[model samples]
Target: MRNLLPLRSALAPTTTVAAFAATAAVTAGFVTAFAAPVAVTAAPAVKLVAADAETNVAAVATDGTTIRYEGLSVRIPAAGEGVQAAAQSTSGDLSITVSRSADGSVVVKTDKHEHSVAQAASASTSRANSAKTCTDSAYQLAGWKLPSFTWYYNPAGTPAALSGTASSAITTATNALSTACGQRALGLATTNGGQTTAVPQVGTTGNCIGNDGRNVIGWVAGNGKWLGMTCTYYKTVNGNKTVTGTDTALNTQYKFFTSTANCSGAYDLQSVVLHERGHSLGLNHVDQTAHASAVMTPALSACSVGKRTLGLGDFQGLVAMYGTK
Candidate 1:
């Protein structure tokens, strides 16, 4: 089953504080002949503190050179200079500029724009409502640099008639994701990892859970409700965030259509594999009824073959996370 978990990516903060400058006012009264003219110098620069009491910082780099607070990540590009920060949200992307002052402090500023209360309310409502529904977008595996996957072939537990076709379907799904990412996202390889014990009888488990990071793909009997499952695990590697591995399992108990077209009552092998691959590639279910056409939709009705091809939104999400080749 496709998990409905929220896709939480580190975003740069949207709020900003402008540099404060004090204006000097000169009195209009005529100066006495003996009075010397007063020269006015610019106000002193505003000092930036290393931290603020009210700011909610999410994650900070160990070296203190990078700080992620309120969806914004501020990076000190160079010492004794300035910082660059960026943020992205459904509304749009925001960029923040940080300048060093003469007083050895930093000043942060953002582009001025009107934020309506209606927009904030709408966003809040959408978030609240989406807590239970599937997401409309995809998320990248956190801290992943050059992310890729390797799936081990396992046909021992699979149905004999469908084995070859199933393996081919896995390859097709891998290629689809790679094409969407505009880079190689998954590959085939050999490994000695044992079969996963994560499969739960359909009614026995409410949510899919288990070991990840081996990049293994195989078959197992499932309780009828789910056709396939994928679990991805994450870790930090040498200060870079990355997905350690993903395990994809198909239900051997269910009848699947191995042929390319027109299997009246059976599920499409490629369709299920494609959906599971999306999960392994850091995509959550787009379960909303409005997004039913998306390949990432949580539920797949039997005999539905349309999902074998990527939907527009699904493709956009892939491009959003991984740039074009």
Candidate 2:
């Protein structure tokens, strides 16, 4: 059965903006190639931690109910669905959501919100003292990791503007995530699995598909509502919930630039992709109000390229989760 959830109800409204600019959505998000699927173990009635701050929120909930965490919210899933979580980007701020599945698995989603240059500048000015003191050194733990996984690119629906450089930009984005821990923890192919018909499982309206046992990343029509979205799926293995699949979708609604020098009013593809990739790797959104420079922060500014590199908190959080290689 298709695990369905309406986007409008799932992603709650911020004070100033709605969750997504598009319509409703369906289920969840990643890697490896040509390997036989591993059987997943299931346990019942798992409760997730709910916190008001961004750094301590659990990425998935196996309790079979909807949940809200500060800036994040997730809806319950249809029966027979595996776990999934999502990270979403908006015109206002970034946030994350998680859902429970019938089989005791979980899902997570995350996004990066977009902001005007003026607003970005003002935020920086106000946080200047904080940034200097390393107050930006906060990161969220999504409770899962992809120690080794293979991801593929599906450029079939890539936007015309990003077509020329999307592949290389994605490569750089994923690489940044891999090396943040001081070693090549991600076992992705130096070159991706090449283009395929498989698009990311994330829906245009911010829903996701169940784990299909493939990790695909690509573009889709999102109509400027979001910059990028990531969905992560988890399964019980030896009483521990481990990530089984993840997928990322880049919205074609907004214009994106590959080069900082050439960026004008457009977003930076690598920066946005890097943030989304952080979600895929089990990093939740830090509070942008407090950690504006961190890649895991919930919002981003137009023409910003700093996110292409991990900030101090981003690095520490990654090390805390995956440990330094």
Candidate 3:
């Protein structure tokens, strides 16, 4: 069933954050796709931390359950059920489905025919996967540095049914992402320093410079920001709000979930968003390898659950942008 989010804060805490309003950055001088320096780093690895049953974080992975998401309405009628997803990362094969009950309630699902952690290895093998090396300055962002999968929304992976356990799974996955992203934010703050005063953007919503104390999240976010953005899809709109600020989320009501079939925990929407938010904070993806896994790794896997919780590399990266504590 569809869970409507109540009008709330810039970032509201919900059982199903994806069912709640949720809300980033990109690579490039402005922000577009994920790119990396010509240099290289070692392979990538991850470490994990259990923040709570619902939340886990990886400093190297990004942040944590502080992440959030929203359920999207899909209209595809080909397979079993139409899926809900705003965007899909082209990183691999993905399908979406959703089924509506007579009650006008929505049940979503996805099927990632082919998407895996090993695939990430082959997909982004160069500086593209350079999130492994933080010491390399070539992997820096000017105003904002976009990552390889930093497209507005990459061709996402397979999706699962929205109803049944899918919703809970989706919600859990979202929370996990928030936790991971949150940790990375802290990592940035801790590495560079901690925030004490105002946000540095100078505007209600703007690009993130680095964690000064206050986050560079967004503002127009409320209720279900993602849901509200539905009116702008495929209309040359700005897509989802990509600004930076603290506690800001995407158009909750406006989310268009990617497929969910194999997505189960394979792909955490909230976690993915949380990772993106990290980039907005001026943190870039750490190359894979280095006997360390970064929150910025291009791909995420179940085995990476722990490492996804902010790690030292992630913290230091944030520090590099903001200041070291």
Best by TM-score: 2
True-vs-predicted CA distance for residue 126, candidate 1, Å: 30
Position 139, candidate 3: lDDT: 31
Name the regions of candidate 3 deviating beyond 4 angstroms.
Answer: 1-265, 289-292, 302-304
RMSD in angstroms, candidate 2? 12.1
lDDT of each: 0.44, 0.58, 0.28
Off by over 4 Å in 1: 1-146, 180-212, 236-241, 260-262
| lDDT per residue (tens digit) for residues 1-325 in model 3 | 1111112122322121121111223221122333543332322221222212322121112112111122222222221212122222324222222322334222232223223444221111133233533332223221222121111221111122332333333334323322232243332221212222332221112111222223322212223212111101011113222222222223222222334333332333444444544544444333344323455444444212333244444544444545422
What clash count does candidate 2 reach?
29
Question: Candidate 2: misplaced stretches above 4 Å?
Answer: 1-84, 93-96, 99-137, 180-191
Ranking by TM-score: 2, 1, 3
Q: How many backbone clashes does candidate 3 have?
A: 128
Instruction: Score residue 33 of candidate 2 by CA lDDT.
Output: 34
Count steric clashes of candidate 1: 12
Estimate the Cα RMSD of every predicted model relative to the unseen true structure: 19.9, 12.1, 22.9
